[model samples]
Target chain A: MTATVIDGRMVARGVREETARRAAALTTAPVLATVLVGDDPASGVYVANKRRSAAAAGIGDVHRHLPGTASEAEVAAVLDELAADDRVTGILLQLPLPGHLDPARLVERIPPEKDVDGLTTRSQGLLARGEPGLRPCTPAGVIALLDAAGIGLAGRRAVVVGRSTLVGRPMAQLLLGRDATVTIAHSRTRDLPALTRSADVLVAAAGVPGIITGAHVAPGATVVDVGIHRTSDGLVGDVDRAGVAPVAGAITPVPGGVGPMTIAMLLANTVAAAQTREAAR
Target chain B: MTATVIDGRMVARGVREETARRAAALTTAPVLATVLVGDDPASGVYVANKRRSAAAAGIGDVHRHLPGTASEAEVAAVLDELAADDRVTGILLQLPLPGHLDPARLVERIPPEKDVDGLTTRSQGLLARGEPGLRPCTPAGVIALLDAAGIGLAGRRAVVVGRSTLVGRPMAQLLLGRDATVTIAHSRTRDLPALTRSADVLVAAAGVPGIITGAHVAPGATVVDVGIHRTSDGLVGDVDRAGVAPVAGAITPVPGGVGPMTIAMLLANTVAAAQTREAAR
Candidate 1:
């Protein structure tokens, strides 16, 4: 039997529409300050899409672009300005900052309340403590995707492949928060397929192309592929879709799946940040 | 084959001796300020033992005991004093604060630098981000125990039975940080034995007595039991020792296992805090 393809674009639109409604209800316009350091083509595309999504959601976008030669202190100064700006409700620092700049230090400059990207130590700490705070977008989107599909996470044996701070680690924490028995397997994991075969829910975020084959999945288990690799044939995911689709119960496609959800969650987070600031006021 | 009993007391002694050597090299004595909000018999005993351990490690012990009727503000005040005191290298606010007080708020009052207990959100966040910072004691102790035993965590299947922020959550993160395939299983986990049996290194921190038996263990898998329940029959661990011993390669006994390691880690953290402060000075 073929697997049911989870429609991420449709889910993302729903999220964007919901976020727009929330933005309309706010007393003041929600402003998101987007900091883009350097002219990396990929980073530029990501920023442009984020800005477009913010506009669609009725959120104000404040773009701050710096040259490839911008110093760490200069980037930090821009973050400090946005963080202290009363008009700014959220801040997003487009990542992969020039090799000279330390992303962690710059991310920390975004005050926790306004940290829409949720890459700061404080935000991660809040997630770790299970406290209320902005969550990292990709993992948050993954959870939202699962919820939208009506997949029950509680008590499910969910296995996550990859342990990157941006996705894998937080993804495991989110699943565990929902009472799923979450396991994280990285490149160093022994007998990877053996472990994946035991998972009722499998998430692949190893950033490797077509790492998961049909042999890696348990029969009738849900698979969420968080990896997207650009190949001569275009975008490919971690899962070997052709091979695994017939065996798995459900799966998310590469470009349209986790990618759309990430943008949608960013919009949601921005609107949520505005509401939080408003409530505090 | 009978399992090798992990001698936690012996390991703890080694840790303390190493900590004492470090403390002796310090320019000034490292002071650990223990703040006991109420006269909880158990808390008092724990605090007393911690003080005794600190003394043995050549660290200074400063005890602050408040009445059980203390308000949240009063507890905060005590923590505030310890945080600002230049003499206090580390601050430990004993757990199970009076029912009236919110432990989270009081725990947050301890400065991150002096937060020896590592219960604050900042410390937990630093851990999540894999930034170098103080870690929660119990899980840190568990890692120390594993290291002292020459147990290789990398690429191993490590299952942690419990998801507490204090133990299970951090324990999973530590193992994941070390490149172990880490899984967090809680009360909601289905087919617990099936999961535990897959673990090369099984950690039981469920706080339930004798929750893991021989049937739950994979033959030759190392078991670390973190639960200790005092019954009329005497102290019992999460693992049914008599039943699991023959099947396991290595096992840690109840009282002599995690308990000593925890105290030893605390001393290590205290000395480390002092060193950090000294370096900054």
Candidate 2:
């Protein structure tokens, strides 16, 4: 009675390889400039993985190292430098800076064209307007995985759990654009279990592990887990891996689910950045 | 125990009169350039009403009347003309244009500064970013009504019963900015009543009449009805007026509740637009 497991690692590899091929075809080698701030171990791990993935994806000009503990002005300066650099097609600033920094204000300084992370207000505006542009990688990955699964979106009842600006909001927006009747359910939502029971597709992005259990899921629904948490026990997502998998039609696993896809999409976004040189011109 | 009724017509008159005073004070009256395309009777009535309201607010330089059969290029041309107009502080393209026309696209053509209706992507972005800027009238009016009523939003549960860009989405964003634990419910939402019943403040913006009934409302919760539908009996709202009023602590009447607030906010936005000029100087 177990549901199909969504193999995100393999899917992400395919996506990265595809991006590599496309990137190699481009006249100029795509580059990603990542500006890191403060010594957050998680941010360090993420940035390292991204640089490695970029190189593996044939984005050969990737800048692998940036100083940790860099001030807001310094980080913005690095972004400005990269923005002007011909080699760098995309710029991503590792987030949750020191106490004194205004992260959103610094983010606004990144030119929209180089905003691969899609956290910029302008990029969000573009997404809300349903225009083609660089999208938030996590949400973009969710859609890519769903599209890869060949799931029909029309008239489907999709309940997205979480409403953060980064992932949940944009995911609901993308789902809406694909014509799935989408509703965003957040932490404050009452009877969350009851709501999940009615969903044809459930997207768990709340960052709360084991929030959606077996009893909560509708029978035969595709579930995409966008949450990745590391506990003393192990890697887990917002959805209970064992509990909901049996009832769900297909489900994405935790460590392998959205994590790898995040890097792959970042590479894809770089290729997209380079392609804009032609598509927009 | 009947809930206190919030009067909107009276509030709207206050807003309109304030606008009139400012308009009268201006050496050269501010103009509201209204562009309408394709003769939809409802749209015609709406635009004419806006013109009368503009005049009543002492805003004399109202450039009313636009072609119904205007081409996209022609409409854009009008928008461009308005954008260049020094006297026009507010430019609004009346909604639901002809089949071939894109209302969203036309809304973009209005200069962001002159986008008095606050439907442009830029304005929406400003709202999303929690920046100082113009806002959508209906949603802005709802917030203003709460403020006017001396309602405190801190640590409150705000339920916005809709998800459209113009009202529901922005309303939720506004409430989030105000520290309300916000939830957005819609047609696809399961057990919508259970969700609404927990709200300290309930906003009905779904445009469906008699949707939020007595059973759906929380006892002593402030109810702000955003829906205004013409029923066979008369004007109606998403909240079941008669049924929910007695159970609610504060209720906004249909004709007098959100309607006047909309016009008042529109006038308020115009004043804000004028103030921006001085700030720029």
Candidate 3:
């Protein structure tokens, strides 16, 4: 374990403290509207964590939980109400909705200013245009982690595995925004190892557990694992930690790395929305 | 000169013919509202060509020419009028407005539904999300050229030089959408030749004449030159045509390449916008 573990928990704590300080200075307290459509146990836990973190950061949390069989219209109605609410500074729509619900339509209902999760087309569009707006939490968190580690992205070769709109795509855009020569590789990419080996900064986000090994990593490259899978033993990431740690320069741990940073970024976005709304007013 | 030249003019003719057929079949005649805010000779020529192309494609062209001293507010007013016009199927705002005007604000004035250039935030957002919308002209033209050449983009290593929103960024996104391992290299990127040499498909869009030579290109790679520089020695492209022809499997020329295809895609977008508007009605 010669590689330095990027301590996301420590950095996340710093983020929350700074967010709390900023929230206290605001003339109006920020309120986050959280909508959970189904009773997926994992989603429930995730929502609960966010609420708890919001409170700890001195922000108000407004939770709306619908039945598991809720229709898309029903969910959209909730989003519309939240969007029009003057008290709500940001909105978080818990993912993995019931099978029948159209998540895209529901996400579109949240206005770009209040979209804390940054999943709406407008937020993605703003990002694509390199405009200042609420960015996706996980990818933004990765940026914070890299900054915390004092890693420079400019002119570096960044290779991202995965192309999900939620993570990989936005991640690549963020890297590109910072002037990194970015390459996005997916399941269809040929000679994956050769591509990975060429990266100065490698981001593993394939969601498949233990998909990246030492052979797939470049020597002295910084690896940020964005995938997390929980099994009976414990939580694991997309990268083979034991195999990659010896070969990599820096690696993030599964439980404490990107996971904590995501919650922190959500809080940061909520505060930012509050500030932006206040300024606009 | 073993490389096959990608014939843009012939392909553009095919495209215009198809668009004319589609326009003729429409219940209502498609009308394009073009706003030219400056007296720049190049812009004037570009706008004139666009109108001529629109007529050839059986689409009505409505030209609104403003003086060089026109205010941003005035240009925006014209866009607003076009946006509300029931007969207007698509809106085109010519580039390089007056010195006092902010082009971004004026461009945003055109409603997303009628933004034929695909430069609006909403249109860009839709593309970033991989949703169906009017795409940028030049990048869409590049995709059309590739399809016409019987080149498969999926699983290929595609390298794009330059990161201008007009060409490189959107081009990378289009390639990525087609399952290609996409890389974006800009002026700030390190080791340009090494990076370009690794690509299966190379797109030169830096707007610099003769920036990419044979040594910078991978042998047998398909090269698309988006830059068109008018020099004393006639027109040239970003890729060194004479130097790269022997190395590349296929290449596009400066005069007959991307230049013709851009107007073709614009006509295609106008027809597509008309189809979408009619469907909504």
Candidate 4:
């Protein structure tokens, strides 16, 4: 029997619709500010998609582009300006800033309230402590997907195969917060299959394409793939979908699974930031 | 085969000696300030032990005691005063403050540099991201114990049976940082033994006395018991020593095990905080 496909686009659309409702409810529309450091084609496409999505969700969009040779101070100045602007509700800094600039230092400059991507140290700390604050979008999106699918996490054995700060680590924390017994396995893990097979809910975020196949999954277990790689064989995810789908109970597909949910959650965070700022005012 | 008993007192002595040397090397003596609210006998004993250990490690000690009726603002004022005090190298606010007062709010008030206990959100964030910062003492102590025992954690399966902010959560992060495959099981976990028996290194911080027995251990696994309970039979930890010792390769005993290491690490953090402040100056 084949597995039930967890459609991310459908869930993300529901999220975007809810976000639009909230955005419309606000007297002043929430604004998402995009900061692109270089002219990398892929980064440009990603930024443009986010801006268009924000607009569709009834959120205002403000885009700032920096030359490929932009200095750290120049980027910092732009962030400082957006951070101080009353119209800007949330800030998304396009990543992989030319190799010369430090991402951590620049990301920390975005005020935690305005950090829609939730990459700031302050935001990370809030998530670690289970405090009420913006969370990293991808992991938050994964949670939204799971909730929409009606999967119960409490008392479940959830294994996250990857330990990235962005996805794997925070994913484990979110699952743990939901009362799932969580395990995090990384590059140094021993007997990878033996560990992954014990998972009732498996999350693959190793950034390595086709790393998890049928042999690694527990029979009838729910699988969530968080990796996306452009290969000669078209786009592929961390999990080998064809091999694992028939064995697993449910699985999220690449491109349509975790990808769309990310931008959707960013819109939700933007509206939440606006509501918080307006409440404080 | 009998398990090797990890000698915490011996290891702690060495740590304190090294900490004293560092404290002496600093131009100014590092000072640890303890804030105790209410007069709980157990808390008083805990604070006294820490203060005594600080003096033994060549660290200065300052103590403040508030009556049980103290308000939240009163505790906040004390933390504020200590935060601004140039002489206070580290602040240790005794836990279990009056029920009316909020510990999390007060803990956040202490500057991250002076937060020796590492209970603040900022410290937790730094740990979650694997950045350089002071970590929670108990987990840090457990790591030191494992290091002193010459147990290599890389590529090992380490299961932590607790999800507490002070110990369990940070313990998993520390193990993950060392490249171990880490799993955190809490009360909501299914089949505790099945999950725990897979660990090469098992940390029992469940706060339940003798909850783990021989049935829960794999042959020749390293076990670190972090619970301390006073009972009719005497002091007992989360793991039943008589039951698990024969099955385990190594184990830390109660009372003289993790307890001594906690105070030792606090002293070390005090010196480190002083060193950081001095270096910045």
Candidate 5:
């Protein structure tokens, strides 16, 4: 069967439009404080893209960059200020900050209501209890893609490759919330291919290029690629598209599959963050 | 191959002796407060057993029951008072309260620092993040029992049936921490027998009698029964003990296997709470 490509860009555009409408409806623009510490070009580009996206979604209350040498105490203080500020509805801390700053401590400073990235301990607790909250963007994007692909999660077998807190762990919990039978696999896992073959739905989040191939896919399975790698040739996903496409009933293409969905969910979370803060008021 | 019969009562004595030794080393006894709502005979019996166990462990400061008609606000106030008091190192809230009461809400009210049962969202978050914190009793007890029975969790294939927050969910997390390849099975799980046949360690927390049988167990698989049923046949575990024993390497008996271990861990948590509070001072 020919694999149906999941169109993340189009879905993201639709999401952006909705966010724009929601932003316009509010008296104040939904502000997202973007904290970027280091001059890592990639991080800079990513942060810039987010600022543009947030602006496009009508999020105009922009708070930007801090120097790489900023002390941990200073970063935490900024987060605390943002948390206390009634004007700022969302906080986005650019990751891979300087070696010295404690990301967990700084991230925890973002109030649970304004934690659009869903990185706070409170957010984790809410998700663990299967309660509604602003969920982690990337993991939430995978679910959004699954929905777009018309995959039924109830009673389905899902194997998530990688067990990172940002991806695999939350993804498994999200799947379980939808009543899917979920299994989490990591580097320490034994017989990886054997475990992969049993999955009716496979989500590869190991961040390694081409770790999941055609051989690992169960025939007629829907595979969502969560890995992104850049090589001299081009970009690649965990799954080898050419090798796995033939066997997969429906598969998400690397560049277009899960990527755009992440941005879409980020917009969604920011809107959700706005609503959460609003609801509390 | 015959299943090893894990003696929970014997293990409990060992744990109590250790607790006693720790108490002797301390300048003062660890104080634990027990909060019981309503006079359900069964709940009263359970609380009484906990108090007796606490006494045997040389634990002190037992607080008596409050009334059944306690409002949520009232309960929260009481919990808040206990949490603020330095003398109370640990707190226990007996279950199956009045019909109108929300158990989750009440459990959430207990300060994570004083929650010996480890039922709070904070504790669950710590578990998810692989941080060291008090764990839910039955799940923690399961690991302790396995350790006492000479079972090392490294490289084991563990299958946990059911996913309740108290038992199965935390049980899976603990097993994963121990380096076990864990799979959480639930009501929606298909081909359970096939899955169970490959398990090296099986835990049944479905609260259903005889859900796991000899046929489901792989030959010489270690089984830990978490379900306790009070049927016409008397108290029984989720496993069909007679049929499963011959094919299993080790098994925990229903009434004795995991039951005593729960209270043992409770005592352990209380003592740890005391140490933590004192150190904080």
Candidate 6:
């Protein structure tokens, strides 16, 4: 049986439209400032995508670039400037900065209120406590995709096959917040199939290409693939689509699945951040 | 065959001895200040126990008592005073303040460095990130108990049977940090026994008395019971000792298990907080 494909691009569009509506309704247009360090081609492409989307959503966009050799203090100064700028509603720092720079130190500097990516310690703390705050875009987008597909999470056994701070960890917290009994499996997890086969909702975010296949899935289970690795065969996700698609009841395609939702969620978060500041004022 | 009883009291004593040594070594005597709002008899007993333990550990102790009708500002003022007081190395506010008070707001007032209880947002964030920071006492104590027992957590299947901010959530995070494949089951979880029975290490913190029994445990699996309930038949934990002991490899008994360890970990965290402050100076 062929599995029903979950269309993430379509779902992300609805989200972007709503974000645009929100941005249009605001008294002052929201501004999303992207801080890019170094000239990594991939980082440049990602920041440009985010900036273009923000502008399309009726939000102002600003880009701050730094040389590869920029010192920690210099990057910190830019963050301080953005934080003090009332016009800048959200801050998005392009990651994988030059190896010499400490990522955690810079992440901590993004004021929680303007942390659109929700990577700050304060944002994570709020998520841990089940408090209302901006959530990490990728996991938050995965939830949006699940909801859009009408997946019932309450009382379901959901297994997240990764534990990275960026995606897997926060994804489990998000599932738990939605009342799914969540399990987090990683490289160290023994008998991965046995643990994942018990899941009603399986999320593949292990970052390893094609780590999940037909044997690892439970029949009729919903699979959300969060991995995208550039392989010889173009791009593949954590799940092997060719092997598992027939066995699964529903699945998200790698390239168009979680990818589009991420940028859409970023737009939503930026607008929400601006609305919060406006309300506070 | 009977399971070995994990002696929490013995382990806790060892920790307190170390804490005392550290406290004695400090240039200025470390001080722990506890704010008790309202005269909750149970809270009073708990505070007194902590004070007695602190004094025994060579740490200075201070207590601030406020009437049940204390306003939010009044409680905030007390916390602010303690936060500004250089001599007070750590601060703990007794839980379950009068019904009129907002606990979160009060808990937020405790400075992260001085938050000996480790209930603050910053502490939880640090725990989530697997960074160095004070952890919630009960979960930290659980890890201490596991370590004392020489339980090998790496690559093991660990199931946490709750998701409370105070215990279950942090417990899962700590176990994950130890390289255990962690699954969090809660009240909404289905097929609870099937999930719990799969665990090589099962932690019962569901706060439901006798919720976990022999059927929920895998043979020879280590069980840590974190629930304490007052009943006519004496104190009972989430695990039915009579039912689970015969089937388990080792277990922590209710009164002598987690209870003593909580106070011990609190002392450890207070000393650690003091050491951090002293190091900065």
DockQ of 6: 0.88
Clashes within 3 Å, all models in order: 0, 4, 0, 0, 1, 0
DockQ of each: 0.91, 0.23, 0.88, 0.86, 0.60, 0.88
DockQ-better candidate, 2 vs 6: 6
Per-residue lDDT of model 3, residues B31-134, tens digit only: 99888886899999999999999998899989999988887778878888899999999999999777899988888888888989999988888898888999
Judge the docking of candidate 3 as incorrect, acceptable, medium or high. high
Candidate 6: list runs displaced more than 4 Å: none
How many Å off is the CA of B19 in candidate 6? 1.4
Question: Worst ten-residue run, lDDT, model 5 chain A?
Answer: A272-281
TM-score of each: 0.98, 0.75, 0.98, 0.97, 0.96, 0.98
lDDT of 4: 0.94
lDDT by residue (tens digit), candidate 3, A53-135: 99999999899999998888888888999999999999999998888988888889999999999998889988998889999
DockQ of 2: 0.23
Interface RMSD (Å), every candidate: 0.7, 4.3, 0.7, 0.8, 1.4, 0.5
Give the candidate order by descending lDDT: 6, 4, 3, 1, 5, 2
CA lDDT of each candidate?
A: 0.92, 0.81, 0.93, 0.94, 0.85, 0.94
Cα lDDT tens digits for candidate 2, A1-281: 88888888888989988999999988878888887776789888888888888888888654534455556678777777888887788988888777678888888887888889988877877776567778999999998888888877766778888878889888877886776656567766667787777688899989898888998899999988988788998888888888987899999998888778888998899889988874655
TM-score-best of 4 and 5: 4
- DockQ score, prediction 3: 0.88
User: Fraction of the real A/B interface contacts present in each candidate?
Assistant: 0.95, 0.17, 0.87, 0.91, 0.36, 0.81
Model 3 pairs whose backbones collide: none
lDDT, model 2, position A213: 93
Writing each residue's lDDT as its tens digit, candidate 6 over B87-179 gives 999999999899988998889988899988889888888888888899999999999999999999999999999999999999999999999
Residue B220 accuracy (lDDT) in model 2: 95
> Candidate 6 lDDT, tens digit per residue, A74-182?
9999999999999999999999899999999998999999999999988999998889899999999999999999999999999999998899999999999999999
